[model samples]
Structures are given as structure tokens and as C-alpha cells.
Target: MSFTNNIFLLMEKSLKKYGNNVHYSVLKEEVLNWINLKDGGIYIDCTCGPGGHSKYLLSSGKEIFIIGLDKDEKMLEIAKENLKGLKNFKLIKGGFENIKEILEKEKIDKVDGFLFDLGFSTPQIKDGQRGFSFREDGPLDMRYDITSNLTAYHILNKWSRRDLVFIFKNYGEIKNCERIVDKIIERRKKKKFETTEELANFICENFKERKKIHPATRFFLALRIATNDELNCLKKGLENSIPFLKKGGRILVISFNSLEDRIVKNFFRKTECIRILTKKPILPTKEEIEVNPLSRSAKLRVGEKNGK
Candidate 1:
């Protein structure tokens, strides 16, 4: 077997022993709801992650054509392994922003179901080395794709106070963006914002409420969203996808924050092509949150394509 296959086998063995403890996967039925769905229909999983939704949908004894989409190559590789030996499932290593183009290329005019579970996975945060979580001290690199040129390393130091303040204020919702920006600018001039620890320390020193969530939390979020163009991507993806969904087809999005949730909310509310199934998002259960603390912020909203 190839190296990718080896990784899959290793993960499978680990999962067999540990269940879903290690990965914290969302599980198939929880998100996809196979019993409520149809078979042999086309479905799209925009975030794809490790293919839990796709695997669940296919395993429900259904003959479905599924596409798993993501921007990160490493994560895509992991999805490939979990979805190995499935001929009906196709994995696309691309951003959800291009979902329309992807479908058009496949010669598919429309699909029955679409899913987008936004943000990073557990393997991404818990690994601590990826630098996505402020709790974990690693390099300041938060780029979703390591192959990408821009990173938190560059943004914290290079961006002007104006840009820094704007992102912190808008994205992080950091009430004290000015203070945070000032600190970042002052510190970076003497040394550099190359590591996560340096940035975290700067925030702690400058902000009074840093202890609540590590002052770097929102700043880092702003940087990550700006670097990846996440909101813009979601907008583009939703714009492109509306036309490609089959009549009565479903669009399910799991957003991690208010910004992303708002995007999905507005798009579904305004668009003629989609009818909102969830006027309000479905949040994770208290039990789920208790079991997996990472699930606290998760919100799920669903939409259905109108007019066949």
C-alpha cells in the first residue's frame, strides 16, 4: 500500500481501539441523517474533513454519488484514506468557494444535498504543532494550507496598526482592538512575532481580560480569516452553489462563529433558490458539549433548494 494508505490503516486501527475519542469526528448519522435522505442522489460535502458525513451517507445502504471538498491537502489525504475503496465517492482538493465550478466540471447540472462544516478539525487544533489554537504554544503559523505563503508570522509583525485594529475589531470582535494592535506594533518593532508564544505573551501583557480567552484568541482568529479569506470564500461558495443544487435539495452548513453563521443566514434568507429549513441554527447539545468541549461553538443551519 502507498504511504497515504498506511496512514489510513493506522488511523482505522487506532479508531477501532479508541472509538471516536482521539479524532472527535462528528459521526455519520449525527450530521448526515441517512434515514431521512434518499439513495443514488448526488451530494456534496464542502468541508469534507475526514469524510464522516460521506461515509455515513454511503454506508446507509444507499447508492449515492458524493463529492468531498476541502482546501487542505493533508486533511484531504486523511479523507481519502477514510473513504478508500468507494467508487461512487470523489474527493476534490479545492476550496468550497469553487463548489459551483467543481460541479460544472463534473458535468453535473445539480445535486441533491450539500454540506459545509466550516473551520478546522480536531487533528488540526489538538496536534498543538499546527498553531491554530492559542492554548497550544507553537509557531505563529495559522495558515490552513502550509503550502500558502501568508502566515500569522507575517501578519502580526508586518501589518500596520490600522489593519491590525480593523481585523481585531471586525473579526475577533475584540472590544479593545486598539490596545491589542498597539501592543503588537510596539513589540514587533523590537523583536518579531514569529512564534505563537510571543504573540500570546504580548496579548496577555497588554489586555486586561487576556486570562478569559487568551487575548490572542480573537486577534489570531482575525488573522486566520484574513489570511485564508474565509468569509469571502463562504460567500463565493454559496453564490456558486445555489444554482447547482437540484430542486428540493438540501444545503446544510455547520458554522463555527457568528460571522460565518451570519453569512449562511443572510444568503439563505435573501436567495430565491433556497428555502430555509432552519430559521435559527441547531446548536450542539449540552451533553455533546460536556463530552466534547470543542463542540461548544458549533452551530448547524440547513437550507433547501426551491423549485425543481
Candidate 2:
């Protein structure tokens, strides 16, 4: 076997041992039901992290073809391994925002369905080096694509107090954002924030509040969103995809955050060529949450293109 194959083998072993920590596809039944594929058709897994959904769709007995896209190359590699022996699919290194360009490059004019699961994979959170979680101590780098210039470290250390405050309030929706920003500014004056633990500790120590969630949760979320520019990407991706969907084709989005859900909701509502399929977003079942705790916050919304 080649070195790359060896690496994939190791990844496969690790997943079997540790239980695919990348992500658990939430609302699998609902997604499959809502998508309602019949016969052979081209489907796109826009955020095909580790190929969980793609695998599910491929095994559904339909002669379907999938085009999987993701910004993270490492995740894409794992997805390739996870989806090995699947002959009817193509994996590409790109974000969903480039859907139009990707379709053009593939020489595909239209698709049957699109799925966007907008959540960080469990592996991403568990990998301390990625710095997505405060529970683990690691560098403050939270870019999904490491090649991206902006990172959690840059936002925490370099951004101005005003900008930090804006990020906390707008992106994180934290109530006491001003106080958190003040504390961050005070600490950075002495020594620049470097690690995830450093910033998380600062927030928890200074912000003495009794809450259901961690004090650093909102801060971390804000930094991640800003680092990735996720909202704008989602907006552009959704808008660009409408033109590519075949008549009666569906677009399903599983969003973990309310902000992202709202974006999907509003886009579907306003788009003339598309009709909203789900009046209220679908939530994961109690049983699914029991099996995959990370899936508890997931909300799925769907839309279908109208024949014109």
C-alpha cells in the first residue's frame, strides 16, 4: 500500500476504535425522508465532512451519484477513505459557496438535491490542536481551512476592543459582551492571548456568572464564526445553488446555530424560484440525541426549486 493509503488505513482504524469523532449526521431519517430520492439522480453533499450523509445516501438503494465538497482538505481525505469503493461519487476540495463554479467544472448543469450540514465535526472539536473547544488546551487556531489568513488567535490577540465587542455581541449573542471585551482588552495589554486555555480561563475567571453554558462558549463561537466568515459564505452558497437545482430538486440545510438557521430560513422564504418545504425546521429526535449528544442542537430546514 502507498503512504497515503497507509494514512487512510490508520484513520479507518482510529475511527473504528474511537468511534468516528468527526461528526454524527443528525436527523438522518428526516433528511432521507425529506430529500425523497427516486431512481438515479445527482445529489450534492455540500459539506460532506467525513462522508457520513453521503454514505447514508449512497447506501439507500437508489442509483444516485454524489458530488461532495468541503473546505477542509484533511476532512476531505477522511471522507475519501470513509467513502472508498463508492463508484458513483466525486469529492472536491472547495467550499459550498463555490457551488456554481464547482458544477461548471464538473460539466454538470443541474442536480437533484443538495445537503448542507453546517456544524463543526466532532473530530474538529476533539482535536485540541484545532483549538475549537475550551475543555481542551491548544493553540487558538480555529480556521476550518488552515490556509485561511484569519484565525481565532488573530481575532483574540490583534483585534481592537471595539471590534472584539462587536464580534461578541453580534456573532456570539452574549449578553455581557462589553464586560468580556473589557476583560480581554485588559489582559491583552500585558501579554497577548495565545492559547485556547488562556483565553477561556480569562473569560471564566473574570465573568463570574451562573449560567447553563460555559462563559467562554459564546466567545469561542464568535471567534470561530469570524475566523471562518461562515455566515457570508452560507448566504452566497445558498443563493448560488438555486440556479443549479433541477426542477423539483430539494435543498436541505442542517444548521446547529440559530443564526445559520435563520439565514437558511430567510433565503428560502425570499427566493422566487424556490418554495419552502418545511414551515418549521426539523429537530433531532430524543433517541438521536441520546446516541449523539452533539446532534441535540441541530435544526434541519428544506427547500425545493419550482419548475418555471
Q: Against the true structure, whose TM-score is highest?
A: 2
| lDDT (Cα, tens digit) per residue for candidate 1, span 121-170 | 75676455678867668987887778878887777778888888888888
By how many angstroms RMSD does model 2 differ from the true structure? 6.7
Residue 189, candidate 1: Cα error in Å is 1.0
Please provide TM-scores, in order, for all candidate models, with all chains considered together.
Answer: 0.88, 0.92
Residue-level lDDT for 101 in candidate 1:
74
lDDT assessment of candidate 2: 0.85
Candidate 1: residue 269 Cα off by (Å) = 0.6
Q: Give the poorly placed runs of model 1, Cα more than 4 Å off.
A: 1-22, 27-30, 34-36, 85-87
For residues 1-308, write the lDDT of model 2, one tens digit per residue.
Answer: 54333434554555567774556778888999999786779999999888889999998888999999998888889899988887799999898988999999999998999999996886787688999988769999998998889989888888998898888888888767787788778888899998999988898788864456667777888899999999999999999998889999999999988889889989998899888889998998887866665676799999989984
Off by over 4 Å in 2: 1-17, 20-22
**Model 2 lDDT-worst window of ten:** 2-11
At residue 150, what lDDT does model 2 achieve?
92
